[model samples]
Target: MATRATARPRSIDFNAAELMVKTIKGLTMDAVQKANSGHPGMPMGCADLATVLWTEFLVHDPSDPQWFDRDRFVLSAGHGSMLLYSLLHLTGYDLPMSELQNFRQWGSKTAGHPEYGHTPGVDVTTGPLGSGFAAGVGMALAERFLAARYNKPKHRIIDHMTFGVVSDGDLMEGIAAEAASLAGHLGLGKLIYLYDDNHISIDGATDISFGEDVAKRFEAYGWHVQRIDGHDHPSIREAIASARDDERRPSLICCRTTIAKGSPNKANTSASHGAPLGADEVAATKEAMGWPADPFHVPEDLRYALGEQMPEHAQNREDWDARLIAYREAHPELAAELALLIAGELPSQTFAGFDALLEGFEVGGAIASRKASHKILSKLAANHPTLLGGSADLAGSNGVLLPDTPGQSAAHPEGRNLHFGVREHGMAGVCNGMALHGGVRPFDATFLVFSDFMRGAVRLAALMNLPVVHVLTHDSFWLGEDGPTHQPIEHAMSLRLIPNLYVIRPGDAHETLGAWRLAMERKHGPTALLLTRQNLPTLAESRAEDVARGAYVLLDPAGEGDLDGIFIATGSELALAREAALRLAEQGERIRVVSMPCWEAFAEQDAAYRESVLPPSVGRERHLAVEAGSTLGWERYADHVHGIDHFGASAPAEVLAEKFGFTVEGVIERWAQIR
Candidate 1:
C-alpha cells in the first residue's frame, strides 16, 4: 500500500507535520463516515502532535515491525482509536484500511481498543481508562531493564523510549495517578507522554470530575513537565524533542487543542465526542480544510509521493539488520541468544542448565518454601538472562529479587528487574503488560497477604493466559508477629477459585524448585507460588519431582490401603499428616497421607489421577487435613480439617502454630475425632 496521503494541499506554506496531521484527520473522518461508526474527535484534535512524533521522533520500521529498539507508542485513550488506526495505516504499518473497515466488528483485526498479540504495531491493550497509562509505565520499565542489562558503549542495543497519547479520561482514572507517581519516583527518563487536552470527556467538559494541577502533581512526583499549544506543530515538535533529550527524569508534554477542529457546528461540541460527524458536517469540514479528494479516496499523485518514502523506512530496518549481521560475526553467541530471546524462544542451554541445577537440590534441605523459592529463583536468574522480576515494596521480606541482579532503580530501556513502588494493583497490571509485550518474561512479587490488592490483575492474567508468575510469600499465619493483617488465612483458597491459575504451596526446598519448573512448563496461565515465611524442615520423603505431580502419596499404611483413616496436608503441615499416619498405625488404623501442593495442577490431571489422590469414594471413616490457613478449598479433601479458619494474633512462631492448631498434635487429635 502507498504510504502517501492526500493530494497537494494547495496552501501557501507546505508544512509536512501539518499536512500529515490534516491527512490523518481527513482519513479517520472518511473511514468513520464510510463505516457509519467510530470515535473521531481526538483524531481530529490531536493529529498534529501525533504526526510530529511519528514523522520526526519515533524510531520505528514499518518494514521490520518487531525491531527491539523501536520506540513504543500507546493510545492510552483508546476511545480515540481511529487516531492510532489511521496512523498505523498511513505510516505503512501492516494494518490496512480494510482492517479499519472491520473496526469494532467481531473477528476483525481492529477491535474497539488495541489488543496486544492481536494487532501488528499495537504495543499494548488500552481501554479501561488508566490501564493503558499503566501499560505505558510497564513498556518504559521493560525498555529500562533491557537497556541496563544489555546496552554497551559501542552498541546502543536497548535505548528506546515509550511514548503514549493520552486524553482527559486517562488522567481521571486513579490508576493513572498511581502509575504516574511511581514512574516519576523511579526517574524513568525515557517515558514521554503527549496529553491531548481537548477539555472534553463523554460527560462533557472534564471540569466536572478532573480539576487537579496535573503539571504540579507530576512535578511533585519528580517528572519534567512541558506545556504546548496542541495545534502549534512547531511548539509540539520542540516539546517532544526536549523530552527525548532529557536523560535524568521522565516527561509529560501537555498539548492544548480544540475537541473537533473543523466540523463547523460540531467542532468543540460534545456531540462530536463519540459519533461521526453527519454527512453535511463532514462535507463542511472537508471544504474548510481544502481537501478535494472524494470520501474514502486519495489522489494518485499523493499516493506515489508517499510511496517513495516507504523505502526510507525500509532502509532503516534493512540497515539495522545489516548491523546485526555484522555484530553476529564478532559476537555469534550473543547474537544467536538475542535472536531467540527476541523471538520469545528460550535458549537450549536454559533447560539443560536448569536440570543440572535441579540435581543438586533433589535431596533438598530443611528450608521454608519462601527461602527455597529464592534459592531456585536466584539460580534461574543467574543462568537465564531474560528472567526479570521485583516486589511491590516487599523485596527484602519476600526474597523475590536476589542481590546479584540489582533492582531496577532507573527506568533504563534494558534493566533486568523492576522495583514496583507500593502500588500493588498497578504493579500487577504493569507486569501483565510486560509479559504481553512479547519480548520479556515479567514477574511480580508481594507478600501473600497483599494479594487481595492484586487479585484484579491476577484474574486478568488468567483471563489472557499470560505467564506472569506471582511470587507470593508469607503464605500463611505461620508468618507470626504480624498478626491477622499480615496473615493469608483465605488468600490461598481465594486464588484457587481462579479457573486456570496454578496455586502452589510447596512443603519444602525440593518442592519449591519443582513448583517453579511446573510453572514455567505450564505457560498458558498465571502461576501463584505461595511460599511460607517461616522455615519448615524439608521432609525426608518429599521430593521436587514428586511435588510436580500435584498430589502424591507421601506416606501411607504399608498393607491393606483400604484406609480406616487418611490425613492430607500442605506446606509445614505435611509432617503433621505423617505424624497422624504414624499414630493411626499404632491403633491398627490403615491410613494414607496425601501431600497436595498445587490444587490447580492436581485439578488439571485426569479423573483417574485426581481420584487416586483424593479417592472418589473414600471408604475411610476417619479423614483429616492439616494446614495453616482458611479451610475453604481443603474441605473437599476432608470434612474434618485442622486449620486456622479465623485470623491470627501476634505471637512467637511456635506459639502461633500451636495456637492456630497447625501442629502434629492437632492433626492427631482431629484424626481421632474423625474416627
Candidate 2:
C-alpha cells in the first residue's frame, strides 16, 4: 500500500453524533413518506454505520467532490439511497435539502437509486444489488494500479481507499460472490465493506433464504472478516480503523442490526423493509428515539457539529493540491502524464500512427477480426499508457492478450493487462468501476454468446454512460463445432437495443482498426465490438476513415446505369455481399454492396450522409440485408433479410456457412428472390 499522510486527530462528540444519526433516520423516513414509495428500512437501520464512516473516516472534500485523491464511498445496497443522500447533504456536498424533499420525483437528483452523474456525491450508479459491490473492487484495483505507476518515494498522489455499505441482498447476489472472490484473490487491501447484516429483508428474515456463515465465507475467500454491533458507535469506529490499518487483504465488517432500528413496532420486521411507514408509526418511532416529530427536521446542533469539520475536509483537498505541485516539480515527465490522465484527456498524438498501422494490413488477405483487433489494440496500448484491460479467461481466443505485458496481480500492480479469470459478469462490473474511477480506460473480452452473463453490468454501464469497451469475439455460429450452445443467435441484436451503446461488427482488418479507434475516442457510453472467429478477406475498397460514418458504399455497379438492387451487410458477411454483387454484375445485373458496421453510429450521421450510403430513392424493397446472426431488426433497413433464425449445429466452419446460407452463392440466391 502507498503511504498516506496522517490526518490530524479531532475529538468526536458521541452525543452530537447520536443526534446526527437521528437526523439521518428522520430524513430517510420523511423522504419515503413524501414519495409514498422507497425502501426506508435500510437507511434507518444503517444510519449509525453511515454516520461513523462519512463524519469520521471518509476522506472527501465536499467543496470539490471530484478531487482525484478522495476516498470513494459506494452504497451497494442502493435501495437505501436516502442514507447516501443525507450524508451528502450533511457533509456539505451540493445536494441541497430541496432535492431530498423531492426524492424519487421527476427532475430530482434524489432518484429511487443512486445515479452517478445525476447525484453530486455519487461515485458510481448502483441499484442492482451486487453491481456496486463489484464496481467498488474495480475502483480499488485502479487506485492500486495508479499508485504503483505515479506515486514516488516521497509522493503518494494516488493513495486512496474504496469503502462501500453492502446489505444482505447484495451478498445473496451471484455477481457479488464472483467479485468478492476476485477481490480476495487480488488482496485489495484498500477496499473495505460494511455489511448490513440486518436479519430482515423485503420478504422477511434473511435466514429464510440465506443461512450460510457470511464471515466464514469471506474468511475462506482470503478476506479479513470482523463481526460487530451495528449500533455500537465505538465498535464501528474501531472496526473501520482496523480495516484501514490492514494492508494485506480486503476487509469485511459485518454489522448486525435490526431493520428500522429505532421504530417502535416495525423495528425488526419485514413491514418496514420497503414501503413508507404509516404516519402513526413514523411519529411513534421519532418519539421513541427522542428525535423531533417534525418531518425532515435536522437539529441545529447536528448542523454545527458537521460545520465544525468542514475546514478539515477542505484542507485535505488543499493538501493534495500542494502535494501534486511538489510532485510535478520533482518529476515533470511523469507528472504531465498523470495530469492528462486525471483530466480524462488523451494525448493529442494518441492516434498519430493509426493510418500507418492500418496500412500494414494486406488487402484481400484473410485474417480473423479478433486477430486483427489484437494487432490494433497492441498499437493503441503502446501509445496510450492508461489503456488497461484483459480477457475473461479467453485471452488467446478473444485476442485480448497484450504482448510482453505483465498481468495485474498483487506483485505487479502496474501491469497493463488483467487476468479476470472466467467471471464475465464480474469483469464487466469491474470495467464499469474502472471507467467510473477515471485515469484508466478499461476493456474486457469474452465470446459473444457469453454476453448474456454480462447483460446486467452492461445495462448499468449504458445507464451510467460509462466508457467501457466490451470485446466480444466468436460473433456468429461460424465459430464451428461449439454448436448452438456457444453460437450467438440474438446477442448482437439484443446488445444493440441498449441505448448509448455502440455495437460495432467490423467487416475486416481495416474496419477492425476503425472499430478500435471509435471505442477509444468515445468518451461517453459503452462500446461492444463483435468480432469473428473465421478469417475475413480484407476489402481493397474499405476505407478505415469512412468507418465513423457507420455505413458506406463498399462497391457499386461498374457500368452504373441504374442500380438493380443494393445489398447491406456487416462483419464477415460483407465479403459475401461484395462477391455476390460482382457475380451478379457479370450476368448483367447491376448491384451495389454497402458495409454497415455500426447502426448506432450510422444513425447519428446526418440525413445527407446516410442517404449517400443507402439512398432513399432505392427504397427498402430493393435492399437485401445479410448477416450471420439473428435477422431481427434488419427490417428497418431491408425488406429482405438473410440471417440465421435457428440454432446452429456442430460442424466445420465451411459446412456451417453452406448450411446456413452465409456464402456468396447464398447471397446471390437471396438477392435474386428480393430483386
Candidate 3:
C-alpha cells in the first residue's frame, strides 16, 4: 500500500482550471462508484491535464463534432473512459449528465471502454494498450498528407494537430514503439502525445518490469521530448506551447503525477488503478478536495464557466465556415475536388468508367495473383486521388507500389505511396486511424501469414465498420521454399471468421480486378484480399461481374450428363478444379466447376440466388471442394473437402504440390476414390 505525497500546493490565480479539474474528478468517481466496475485511477490522475487541454487549448465545436479542422483527441488509456465522458458533457457535446450517471451499465452509451462510433468526441476506439497511440500517428499522417495536397500558401485549410494521452502500459506495448519510430522517422510534427508517467502498474510498481528512460528513448527515435508536472496547470500549458513551437519533430510530454490524485488511502497505489475507491474513501477524498458530498455533482461555478465558453467555441466554427466559402470562390476547381474528397464520393467519370476498366484488362498468359493485384492497384491509384497505399517491407513481394507516385515521407507528404517498413501490426493500426480520419481511403499490404500479427487491428476496423483495404499476398503453402513459417495454410479461413470482414481470394487476373473493385466500393466495413504466390491460368468463362454474386459456374459438364458432381474452389485452386473437372469428364462422370471467390459475400445473397449456384438436388457427397488450406468451415458448402490440415514443409512448388496431391492426375485419383 504505497502512497504518494499530497497534491502540491498552488496559487489561487487559476480558479477556473481548478474547478474544472474538480468537476471531472467528481464525475469520474461517482460513475465508477456506481458501476462498481472499471479503472478509476487513470481518469483521476489525468483529469487536470484533460481539463486544461479541453477547455483552453482544444479547438472543437460541440454543435459539430465532425468539423474537419477540429483538433483530434484520442485517449490511448481508454480504460478511463469516464474522463472523456465528463469532458464531453461539460463542453456541451450531445452527451448529457444522465449518460454519465449510467456509466458502464448495459445499453448505456458509456461502455467499459470508449468506442468510437458509440460516443461523441471519441475519435478512435481504444482499449488494447498502444492501439490509440499508434492510431494517432496515422491521424497526424493524414493531416499532413491532406494539407500538402489541398492547402495553398495563403489558405491553410487542413491544419490541425492530433493529441493523445498515453499511459505507462501504452508505452510498454511493442505496437506503440513501432508506430512512434515511424512517426519520428517521417517527422510528423503535428502529432503530440502526453505520457502518464505514474510509476505504478497493475502488478504494483513499474520498477519490477518497465525501467527504461522513456524520454531518452523517444529522443533517440527522433521525437522532441519534454518533462512536466502533471498537476501544474502553467507547466502543462508551457510544455504544450513549447511542443507546438517545435515544427520538425513529434512531441512526447512526460507528465509525472499520482494515480489517484486526492484519494486518502489508495492514491498512487495499484489498488486504485482498477477498482473504485470504497464509499468511505470516496467521501473522505471529496472532503479532502474541499468539494460537496453529493455524488455526480457538477459545481455551479464550473457549469457557468463552461456555459460562457460554449458560444465562443461554436462561433469559431461559424467563422471557419465563412472562410471556406471565400476560399471556394477563389479556387473553384480545387475546391470541388476537396469537397468530393471530404464527402468521400467518387467522381461520376470514375463510376461510369468501371466497365471500361474491367473490359480493357488483358490476361494473355498465366501470372501470379499478386502481380495481377499490383496491376489493378496501379490503375486505381492513377484514377482515384483519395486512394492511398503502402506495404510492411514486402512491397516488392506483395506488389503494393504504385507507379508515378513518390513514397510518402517528411520531404514528400503529398505522395500517395507509403513505405510502412517491417511493422505489420503498426501499419494495420495506422490504417485504421486513416480510415477513421475520413479524407483518404487507406490500404496496407503484407504476407498472408503475417495477418496473425495484425489481427487485433483488423478486428477493431471491422467493429467500427471502417472502409480499409488489406492486401495480403503469398497466400498459401504454394509460397514454397520459405518453409512453414512463411506459408499460409489457414490464414484465409481464419480471417473469414471475423464478423463484418469481407474476405476475397480471387481466382485469376480478371477476378483480381473484381476483388479490388469490391474493396474500393465498400463503405460499411473492412475488406481483406488474399492473393497467391503461384501463377493461375485465366479461365475464358470467368467474368468480373459474377464475383459480386459470391460464386458462379465457371465450367459445366459437356452435354450436361445430369450433373453427376460439382467442384468448388477459390483463388489458385480454381485452376485445379477445372483440371479435375476435365479429368472426370473423360470418365463420363460429368462435373460442374464453381468459382467461390468470397464466401461471406456469397452467404449474403438471397436464398434463391444461393440455391441457383449450388442446387439442393445435388447430393452433399457429390460436392467436392479443393482449397490449399485448412478444412475448417468447408462443411457449410462442400461434403468432401481436400485441404492441408497439417503444416507445410520446405520444398519447391512442384514437389509440394505433388506431395500434397494437388495436380491434374492427383485430382483424378482423389476424385476416383471419393466417387
Best by TM-score: 2
Ranking by lDDT: 2, 3, 1
Task: Tell me how candidate 3 scores on lDDT.
Answer: 0.87
Question: After aligning candidate 3 to the native by TM-score, how far in Å is the CA of 6 from where it should be?
Answer: 35
lDDT values, one for every candidate = 0.76, 0.91, 0.87
Report the C-alpha lDDT of model 2 over 1-675, residue by residue, as the tens digit: 235423433445898889989998999999999999998899999999888988888889999989999999999999999999999998899999999999999999999999999889899898898999999999999999999889888887998889999999999998999899999999999999999999888889888999999999999999999999998989998898888888789999999988899999989999999999988998999899887888889888888999999998898889889999999999999999988977878876678788887888888698999999998888888888888899889999999988767989898888988899999999999989999999998999999999999999999999998889999999998999999899999999999999999999999999999998888889889999999999999889987877788999999998548788899999999999999899998899988899999999999999999999898878999999999888889998998999988998899989999988888888888887775
Which regions of candidate 2 are displaced past 4 Å? Answer: 5-10
Q: Model 3 — TM-score against the truth? A: 0.96
lDDT of 3 by residue, 1-675 (tens): 110011112222277779888888888899999999888899999998887777766778887888988889999998988889999998889998889989999888899999988888889999999999989999999989998988775666777888899999999998899999999999999888989999999999999999999999999999999999998988988787778776689999999989989988999999988898889989999999998999999877778878888787787678678767877888888788878877777654444555665565554568788997887788787778878979999899999998998999999999888899999999999999998887898999999999999999999999988899999999998999999999998898999999999999999988988898888878879999999988888778787888887899999986744888888999989989898888777778889899999998999999999888898989768888889999998999988888889999899988999999988777777777787
Off by over 4 Å in 3: 1-13, 351-364
Better of 1 and 3 by TM-score: 3
Off by over 4 Å in 1: 1-40, 260-306, 348-365, 405-417, 433-440, 463-465, 497-500, 521-525, 547-549, 564-568, 606-608, 615-627, 630-646, 653-660, 668-675
Candidate 1, 103-206: lDDT as tens digits: 77878787877776677887777777777788788777777766565545555455667889988888887678888887887787888899988888878888
TM-score of each: 0.85, 0.99, 0.96
Clash pairs for candidate 3: none
